[model samples]
Target: MKAVLPSITSDLDQAERDLREHGICLVSGVLSAEQLADVRAGLYRAAKLDNRRKLAHSGRRIDHGESNQHVRNTLSLDPVFADVAEHPAALRLVRSVLGWPALLGNQSAFIAMPGCEAGRLHADQGFIPEPWPTLPQGCNVGWCIDEFTEENGATRFVPGSCRHHRPPGEGDEEGSVAAVAPAGTMVVFDSRIWHRTGENRTSDQSCAALFNWYTRPIYRTQENWFLSLNPRILEGASDELLTLLGYKTEGFGKVNGRSPM
Candidate 1:
């Protein structure tokens, strides 16, 4: 649980090194303030839209910090999100952990509203059976919008716990520390890491944390991009984004009567 925070200004090679050593690396200053502003605007708007829909159907809010919201399938929610999800540095880092042909496994918003409690410590690939700790199937990139202070629910992780190759039980987690960083920092971690959200102690601030998860091309993504993405959004997108959406795979979809490459 000791936090081994490497210098976020390290080059890509060092960043990748930290990922291997600690199972997570907080890359500071990856996103510019302007980029953060654009995404935050879109993110809040999308959250409001989603909140209204959820309110009508569930008669309850998602969480409490300010509507403690976790919005899955954010790739299609806003163009700014899409841009960040496919950012060059993030994709390169994820590909280092997953592979050159990695696909976008999932994208979502994890808003820590004030009073939002910590989530269970877990690996992103928490449910694959029998395979045990086979090969790694994922890597996650957290695009932090607001600064991640211990009091504002910064994620916490156990250093080098990925080597355990199995989930840590409640008794196993000790010395956990928060992955603290300023706003616009990008947190990249191996999916096998033992980590979870920490409690948001603030009374009025809601933290906006966006997660863009990637995995091998063969594994299924959490969000079905084909179904969720608007046709306009998909139309004429760059080849890279298309591939991340699993359009590069042969079995699941075909375009123009031929398999997408």
Candidate 2:
């Protein structure tokens, strides 16, 4: 079960190399101190708004068994969230793993609270039936708003597991390591890698992580952008944003054989 730990680097070239060889890479300093602070605050603000709405309707927590809060459809929650999703650093890595025609599957907040239990270990592409292709069908970018540490529920990854063409089984957890990195780092990993959220053992601090997931254009996105994005956000989207949202026509997204864009 022994495996090499994921490579951590500030250089994109090194990160790309790690991704291809190790299945995971941590790109340090993807955000400035000020930017990280703003995103951290934005995450809580969005959580508060979502909580208020849920409380009004007696809604149960989406993460029922986990000691964490989930904020879905973050793009329309705040301007900062949209900025996080469209960050140049993230887009570059995503396209590298998932191809230029990648569509943003979703942008959401994963706030792991103190005492949170470790999550179910699995690959992001597990839904796709095996034998899995060598090429990844998706990529997941984790934006670390708070310093990620094993004590604070950092994600765990089984290094080089992306090379496995099939999903993990009963004993795969033995090889995993926590993806420790500083605040403002961006964690880019191939969706085929086996990963899970580590347990939060801290007394007070919550791990504020934002995940922007992308997929090949042939697959439908997790969030239905057409129905969920705020109208104003759509109106003001850049051409690249539109393309990521699946507004631009690729080979399969055509409407009656015509380009949607």
Best by TM-score: 2
Model 1 residue 173 CA deviation in Å? 2.9
lDDT of 2 by residue, 1-261 (tens): 467676679999888888888878899878878888888888888888867777312335433334677878888876777777888888888877877877888898778889887888888888898789889898999988888998999988888788886788999889789888888889988889898888899999888889998898888888888899887777777777878888888523788887787
lDDT at 82, model 1: 77
- Write down the lDDT of every candidate, Cα atoms only: 0.77, 0.82
**What CA RMSD would candidate 1 show?**
3.0
For all predicted structures, in order, the TM-scores are 0.89, 0.92
* RMSD for each of the candidates: 3.0, 2.4
Model 1 alpha-carbon miss at residue 137, Å: 1.1
| Local distance difference test, candidate 2 | 0.82
Q: Write the per-residue lDDT of candidate 1 for residues 1-261, one digit (tens) a residue.
A: 345756575478888888777778878667788899998888888878878777412433333344357776777766777789889899888877877777887888878888887777777877666355655778999978888888888888877778877777777667677878888989998878888788898998777889988887767887788788766667667777878887764325677877586
Give the lowest summed-lDDT range of ten residues in model 1.
55-64
Displacement of the residue 122 alpha carbon in candidate 2, Å? 0.7
